[model samples]
Target: MPQTNGNAPGRCAPIPKTIPPMKDLTTENITENVIALNNLCSDPRTRYLFERLVHHLHDFARETQLTSEEWMSGINFLTAVGQISDDLRAEMILLSDTMGLSLLMDAIAHPRVPKATEGTVLGPFHTHDAPVTDNGYVLHDDPGAEQLFVLCNIKDTEEQPLENVQCDVWEGDSHGFYDVQKGADRQGPDGRAVLRSNSEGVFYFTAVVPVPYPIPDDGPVGGMLKLLNRHPNRPGHIHFMLETPGYDKLVTALYPRGDPYETSDPVFGVKESLIVDLSLVDEAVADKYGVKVGMKLLTYDFVLASDEQAAELRKDRRKEAAAKLDVDISTLHLD
Candidate 1:
């Protein structure tokens, strides 16, 4: 037996080396390691979100035992989605809408907003500024279908009327193509308008009854549709974005008369409250609205949410515009 002294370096006892068990390095262990990596993030919100995302993503991978080949395929799909994007298109947002994520998020964020008209996804084609028109003007730039008059009113949740509100409207022609999509040089508010409500809270516009048409399926989103055996069509509807000083803005669409896809809008934007009945009437009613006689008339009411909610709705539009520009919004210092 060798004598050992605690104070002398040469006689000191051997130091104990403890190693973590190998079983602790399973998939769950790797997940915990990934979460720990989030400590390197300086932004609190980013760190919190990335940590949770890693946990769930790792859990999902482990549960499915996802293979490397499958993971690489997903990466390729995403890469194609990004490569397909250009100045006039947004494949990622379209993908989200087609998968119903956009609608689900909208439902959660805009819960039970009273007097506030239901909000829907604004598709990727909204022009920054539509041509400003007066109370009763036509928005149809290229003609293809029968004329229809849209008479709408803006009111608060209490049913009290609101005036001086801004209403932006846009829709495709009977042929199912927006003016912007028609040609590269043909982009200048061709089929869009921004109108102000009258003193009676009424806004009137004349246009052809839009026909149900397929969304652009010539890109990656289209490939997804082909794979899923789904059509990229949306119902015939007129888009509306209304805003007032003290009320929530309403982003919605009004389905046309007897649209085939009304029940199966690809974007899940159809709302029972937003549907309008286009009654075929004699020329008398049409003449009063400065519209052609014998054309159908669709009348609907737009109820706005509170002021705070309206602001939030507008914020979404601003974000969309910023994304299209592909610039760092924080650096822009925009008002």
Candidate 2:
């Protein structure tokens, strides 16, 4: 046997000439392998989604030459994001909004719905079964700066009135805090109310104009924003969830005039059609709606989609109610 430099007889042999060199395995080869694996998905939807995802993800990896450490860090960030969510919070949705994905999806999925009110993100704060107040009750039970008066109308695209349309509305206070967030009143849902549109397809309410405020920054999404040197603030807006038996339901927000972030909302939820100038009304005109003079009035009409979609939307409302009850019971020890 041939003697090796430091091995005994029969322990050494020439390396195989047919073996491929490890150095030939490059990033491009790895990316190609990932693409091939993605194509192996059999489910049509899964295959379609994963194929696109793999292509983009590989392209991103190549573009950035992302290291294993960087990839692991991203995985860790997503893990923490999921860890921070609870019954009352949706951290991932907030992350999506801040990243502009939510707005894009809303725009694509909602389309114009053809004369129906454009839908926007149902921000993470909606609570179910708000007190059913009369058409003119104040949403904000307490007084605050920037008086707000809202006149809402519900109708078909053809301008036919939708009687008994349910409108569920809520908003932050002048200080940008929802009633429940402030723990102001435990007996009822705070900063939230549901009212029905009258025979004229009209509903009115009084409240202080909500102040623009930042989304919660105590979570992973907040950390990312800080890293990106971006503010978490969303513009001043009122939340609305409306539906009628004969039209499509709408979930949207109304942007106030002169909010600093109106045009550049952090969540990208603003729509040009939704922005309305809240004009200062004469006291007499306000009093006609049971509001004081000098109150700021904002008016908008909601055009519902087709009747079939409206029924589905109403069913969603019921499902939302049940889900909320489960959340309350699990978190607050309440019925």
Candidate 3:
């Protein structure tokens, strides 16, 4: 009888010629396997989505030759992101914003319309319960910061003024700190407030020139940026959310012409139409808006989409968003 090599000390048998190699996989078969596994999902949409997601994810891993260690690192990073989330902060939104997914989704859901203000990412700092005040309220009363006058005209496509619309505005202070980022000792809402557009659809506020600032980078997303050799800075801009009956809610930001990072906003929130110039105001012009002479002023007119138009544009988005929010699509309005 022939003795196998395993009988020898520290030796193993040679592989049998009859043993077959591991099964070879083709692209079609790889994707087909995932589809077969998920085709039984209870929900048709879920099944379709999971199948496609699995196919693409698998293809990406194979194409990149992803190592097990790298995969583990990604999982660890995501775990960290979830671990650090809280009511005041959402790491997932930050991640999505940094990746430009937020802006992409906004664009897809709210396609641009003629004369309507372009949409932008609702940055991590927006609060629904911003302190409501009359027009011309001061948002940045902190001494020594340059004062800026924000005068915005709210209008419809036909250029008719929109009254009773609330404009929620917020921004970072000169030192790049938002109210929430500062400690409890810091006074509330350092650079945020809500004001209503006047009868002529004009809203005005006194604020500090928002300085360029980095998104919160003390977390996993920041670590990813470091690994990618990318900066975490967003161009200075004032966030605006406009809401009213009979019109679509608008979320947008205004970028100054010379903000250092205007052209290279990390979040890709800048749009040509959203960029405006801040000019020095003469005493007469300044007195017109109630600000003292020699202050800076930014004037912009925002055209809001009518409710009917917005509903038509985001019909599918409404349903999807409603499902996620556990609300009826018919009850969802653009606010």
Per-residue lDDT of model 3, residues 1-335, tens digit only: 32233333456665333222223567557676557646645666566558658978988988898899999998999999999877667888999998999999889767776679999999888866578999989997578899898888999999999998989999888888788777455556668899999999999998888789998899999998888888888888899999999887899999888887888787899998988889877887676776787788888999999988876767767677779967545454433
Best by lDDT: 3
Per-residue accuracy of model 1 over 58-147 as CA lDDT, tens digit each: 888998999999899788988998998776677888888898888877765555465567878788778776888897788876656777
Q: Pairs clashing in candidate 2?
A: 248-305, 283-293
Name the regions of candidate 3 deviating beyond 4 angstroms.
1-45, 183-187, 314-335
Q: lDDT for model 1, on a 0 to 1 scale?
A: 0.76
Candidate 2 local lDDT, 65-157, one digit each (tens): 899999998999999989987756688988998988988777654556557888898887888758888898777656546768888788887
Superposed by TM-score, candidate 1 places the C-alpha of residue 148 at a distance from the truth, in angstroms, of 1.3
Error of 3 at 142 (Å): 1.6
**Candidate 2 deviant stretches above 4 angstroms:** 1-43, 180-188, 282-288, 307-335
- What would the TM-score be for candidate 1 when compared with the true structure? 0.79
Q: What C-alpha lDDT values do all the predictions have?
A: 0.76, 0.76, 0.82
Which window of ten consecutive residues has the lowest lDDT sum in model 3?
Answer: 15-24
Give TM-scores for every candidate, taking all chains together and pairing residue i with residue i. 0.79, 0.75, 0.81
For model 1, which pairs clash? 115-157, 116-305, 248-305, 248-306, 248-310, 249-310
Indicate the residue-level lDDT of 207 in model 2.
71
Better of 2 and 3 by TM-score: 3
